[model samples]
Target: MIFSRERPFLLVGAGKMGGAMLSGWMAQGIDAAAIVVQDPAPSPEMAALLSRHGIRHVTEVPQGLTAGVVLLAIKPQLMDVVLPGLKPAVGDETLVLSVAAGTPVARFEAAFGPVPIVRAMPNTPAMVGRGITALFPTTRVSAAQRDTVDRLLSAIGTVEWLDSEAQIDLVTAVSGSGPAYVFLLAECLAEAGRKAGLPADLAARLAEATVSGAGELMHRSSEPPATLRRNVTSPNGTTAAALTVLMAEDGLQPLMDAAVAAAARRARELAG
Candidate 1:
């Protein structure tokens, strides 16, 4: 068991990300009885899940209880208001795990003192058990606590530890917002195919399948992506022609660089 049953886990929100993590934890065999959810207005789907599992759901943080782990899954905007009330749940031994982006460790320290806090950003693919999450642990975090946090997070997907919190903004721009970029590519590819005379529906299906298949192939391959691209590109072939345009001086790389920079800047703004 990743968590100790002595003190219950207090989940501060039950939105999509929080609910996804909750579902992942339950599916991994964490005791449902050891979990308590605090969300004023959870979706019907999430409410149904809490009911089915018999996990405690509360609109407010209950008094007179010390949580073993307090997972902060609320929005960054709500941190200032909501955190002040969670003091009762955080004991000295508790590990605070946050999945809220743009909210740093200092903000948490302001709320609950110098307790062990880990701030993380997880991509949406975590719901399907294929996500990648980047975490930044404060100096206060113990080695054993880090291991526990790793185990809990690994329930949903890959967990990577960061050396500095500033890198979080860069990560937010890349993998944190990366899935949307891939989806956009698929959309553009389908439109291009339709414009080139393929049936609209067929083009959409082909684009979706190709994107997903390529992603899976990349996932399974040991070689770097460049090697895979080389293997796919035959001399003077259709793919090679397309790559020529995409790899040009003013091509995909520059566009992606600008997009990521913009996202990172926004992340920093949100943090402040």
Candidate 2:
């Protein structure tokens, strides 16, 4: 739903992810003049975009500008300082959506006085408008408000609604931190190729293209990832030879499992 002037969209933090989302929204016909961006240091790209789109980018939360949906995309550690300024504009009917990692709904409620809140975890991919956000809305959020939040978040990428807030930590470990895992895989592949006598640039390009191409194929295919793997692996083939080590008991699976568990634990800890 396009926001009306009666309830403008107030974006807190116009950094990469937030800037990407705003770009998407503008592409989809949202009025930039009706939106306000609060960011201390917007990138050059973001500053140019705000100027082009006629959106307001202010360092302080503007007085008397009511927000229909106040989307918080700031750092979790800075919430105490950042959120207090936002309190005055939060009306009874206003909805709050947070994309700050490891922040819980209770913290928002305590700060904002029982406003409807939706906590979300979005990855860095949102900067490219290909991210997936996992959301958990509190009971105070109505169906209509949820739909609005969905439409707003859809600007970045797909949105997955969760049944419980506890699952957000797992989501944080998985999708929230998943990009780094994929990036590391590509880095390792490139290094291995270089060690195997490929030129540095060639090895890096090959690894990057292979990983990205495989990811694109997986996205377009209806078959499961496991099935895709099997299709690529022939009995006694080079792919199968590589898979043998990868599928071993003490291989990538166990390592990834431990990594995810540790991430989830840290996510929960950060919530405190």
Cα lDDT computed for each candidate against the true fold: 0.90, 0.89
Where in model 2 is the C-alpha error above 4 Å? Answer: none
Query: What is the per-residue lDDT of model 2 for residues 45-73, given as tens digits with 9 covering 90 to 100?
Result: 99999999889889987878778889998
- Compared with the true structure, model 2 gives a TM-score of 0.97
Compared with the true structure, what per-residue lDDT tens digits does model 1 show for residues 173-253? 999999999999999999999999999999999999999999999999998999999999999999999999999999999
State TM-scores per candidate.
0.96, 0.97
What candidate 1 gets wrong by more than 4 Å, as runs, is 1-5
Which residue pairs clash within candidate 2? Answer: none
Residue 4's C-alpha lDDT in candidate 2?
58
Candidate 2 Cα RMSD after full superposition onto the native fold (Å): 1.2
